[model samples]
Target: MTRMFRDPVFGLDADVVRRSVENVAPPGAATDIVDLFARAAWSGIAEPGDSTAGFLVSAVGASAALAMLVERWSADRIVRESMVDVDTAAFATQLDRALVRWLPRLDSRSTVRQLTLAATCRAVLVTPEHPSWPERLDDLGPHAPLALWLRGRTDALRDTAHSVALVGARAATGYGEHVAMEAGSGLADRGFVIVSGAAYGIDGMAHRAALASQSTTVAFLAGGVDRPYPSGHSNLIGRIIDTGAVVSEVPCGGAPSKWRFLQRNRLIAAVGDATIVLEAGWRSGSLNTAGHAAALGRPLGAVPGPITSAASAGCHRLIREYGAVCVTTVDEMAELAGMSPGETNEDAAARSSEETRVLDALSVRSPRSPGDIATRSGLPVGTVQSVLGLLELGDLVAEKPEGWVFVPQRP
Candidate 1:
C-alpha cells in the first residue's frame, strides 16, 4: 500500500513528505531523492518543513533521471525529457527561462499557504495517471488545467457519465428564488445532483432546496475548500460538506479572487454533463460557465423568465441567440442529464388555499378591512366578508374594530 500521512497543511490527507519518504525508489536512495528534489523545487537548497521542497521531492521522485537532471541537465535537457522528441538545448533554455520567471512567485507566503492547504484538504488531488481522471477533459488539450482540486463525493468526480451545473445570479429575486428551488429540487428528484457555486441568492436557494429534497449537490469554490466564501453561508457550507463536496484548485488558504472565480467555472463546465443557467443578467458570471460549456460541446440549458426581468436577460439571450435548450420541470433537467425522472412523492398540504387567502387578506403592517380582500382577490365584498368570517372563525386572520387585517399564527 502507498504510505499516507496526515498533512498538517491540508489537515487530513497524506502529505507529499510521506509519499516521497515511503515511495522513493531504489530503496536506500531515499535521502538522495529527497535532498535533490527538495532543493531543485526550492532553488538548489533544502529548507526544513518547507512545502516547496515537498513538491519538488514528489515531482522528481517519479523518475531518478528527472531528479538527477536538476543538478546536471541544463534547461534544454529538462525540456527534452519532458517531451517525446524536442530540441534538447533549446528546450532546456526555454525551460530554465520559464522557471526563473515562475519560481519566485511560489515563494510568496500566500502561495505557500495556498499550496499547502490544497495538498491537504480532504479533496483528492487527481493526476493524469489516476484511473478516475476523466479523459473528456483532455479535449481541452494543452489548455486544460494542470490538476483538479475536488471536495465532496469522489463518486461524483469519477462518474463523468452525467452531471449538470445549475448557476445564476447571487442577488436573486422572488421569481429567481422560486425557480431555483423548483429546478434544484426537481433535479434532485430526478437523480441529477445539483452543481453550483455556493454564493448567496440563487446559489443558496438551490443548495437548500437540493438538501431539503435529500439529494446530492456539489459546490465549486473559487478559494480553498476549507475556506467558504461570503461567510454568510458558513452554516450552509457546513451542511454541504456533510452531504456533498466542496471543490477548488488554488489550494487551501487561497483567497477568493475575481480571476479564480472565472477560472473555476471552466471546471464546472468541463466536468458536468450539461450546464443550466437558471437566472442571470447580461453581466452575470454564470454566463461565463455557460460559454465554457458551449465551447466544450456540452448540452446547455436555460430557464425562461419574464422578459421585463433583468435577471432573466442572460438566460433569454442564451436561449434566443445561443441555441441553449429551454427547460422548466425537473423531468427536462433529468432527460438532459440522461436519466429518467422517478415517481414523484406526494406531500399532504399543511394549509389550504382558502386558509392562505385569509392570511393574505391580512397585512403585516395593519389589518385589511373585509373590503380589502374583495379588492385584492377580485371577489365580491359579500363573499370576502363571508370568507373573512370563516378565517376569523379559524383564528387565522383577525378583524380590528376599525376594519380587518392579518395576524400571523406566530409573531
Candidate 2:
C-alpha cells in the first residue's frame, strides 16, 4: 500500500520538506520533494558502491524505493513491487542478500535529519537527471552512484571530456610531490581538469598546482562533502569548493572509513579520461586507483623515480610487471588522454601470461599462499608456483611467515 504521512510529531508534511531544500535542487529537474528527500536518505543509508541501492533507484523511482524501505517492506514484497528480477534466480539471490544489508538502515527520521543538515551547509544534490551529472559515471553501469553530494560549483562536473586523475602515495617524497606539481600544472595549462581524492602528500600538491594554473579541479572524497577529512586539508578543501568542486557518494556527516576510501577509488578512475600514478610505495592505496583504471580499460601512466626511492616502487611494479606505460612528461600523459593509446601491442606481447594473474591475486594488505593464489587467479597450482618463483626472483613479491605478500623492494 502507498502511504503519505502528515503527522503533527515531526510535522514534516511533504510541502514543508520541499520548501526547506528548494534552493539546492537541480534547476529544471522534476523535483518532487520526496525524490529529493529520498536521494539524501539513500546517500546516508547505503555506503558508497551499494549495488542494491543503486539498482533500486535505477529501477523504481528514488521516492518509491525510499518509501518501501521506510515502510519496512519485506524482501519478497520489495522484489515483487520493484521488479528487480534477473535470469536463473540471480535477482532473487541479489535481493535476498540486499535485504540483510538494507534492513538495519531503514529509518526515515535519520534521512530527514540528514537532509536538514545538508541544507544548512549549502550542499547540493545531483542525481543522473541533473544537467550537471557527469555522463562518464554511467560507465560504472549498475555501480554508478545513487546521487552525488556536492559542496562546490555543480557546473564544474558538467564536462569531464578532458579530466585526468593524478594519485600517489600519501606519504610522498619530495621528488614525488615535485612530479605531481609539474604534472598538475602542465595538464591544467593544456586544458584538463585535475581530479584526485583530497588526501595529503601527492593529492594535495596536485590540487594546489591545478589551482595555480587557474584550471578547474575536483576532489572526489571518501566521506561527506561537508566533512573535511585528514582535517589537515580543511583549508585546501575550502579553496576547492570556491574554485572547482568537492564531491562524494556519501551524504553529509558520513565518516571516511578504510573500506570507503578503497571504494572511492573507482570513482576517481571512472571520472578521469586517464589516471597517473606519480608515486606510490608497493602497498600504497593509490595503486587501488590504478587497478580500477586498468580494469575499466582506461589508459594508465606512471612516473619513474630513482631506483633508490621506495616511494616509486609501486610505479615500477605497474610498469615492469603489469604493463603500465612509463610517462615522463605531460605530453605523454596527453597522449594517454587520447592523442595515442597507452601501451603498444608489443608491450602486451612481451608479458608472460601468468604475471598479471598472479599479481592480481596478491594483495598489498594481506599474504596468500601459492595454492590460495591459484584459486583467486584460476590457474593451476603448478603454473602459480613457477610464476611466484619468477616474481620472487624479481623482488616484486616477498615471503613472510604467514605467506607471500606484495612488497616494496628493500634498499
Best by TM-score: 2
**Whole-model lDDT, candidate 1?**
0.62
Task: Give each prediction's root-mean-square deviation over alpha carbons.
Answer: 18.7, 11.7
lDDT by residue (tens digit), candidate 2, 185-301:
988876788999999999999999999988889999998888998799999999999989999888777889999998899999999878999999999999999998998877789
- Clashes (backbone N, CA, C under 3 Å), per candidate, total 11, 0
CA shift of 87, model 1, Å: 9.4
The residue-level lDDT of candidate 1 at 335 comes to: 45
* Per-residue lDDT value at 289 in model 2: 96
lDDT (C-alpha) at residue 123 in model 2: 84
Q: Candidate 1: list runs displaced more than 4 Å.
A: 1-16, 19-75, 84-101, 107-124, 128-135, 340-411
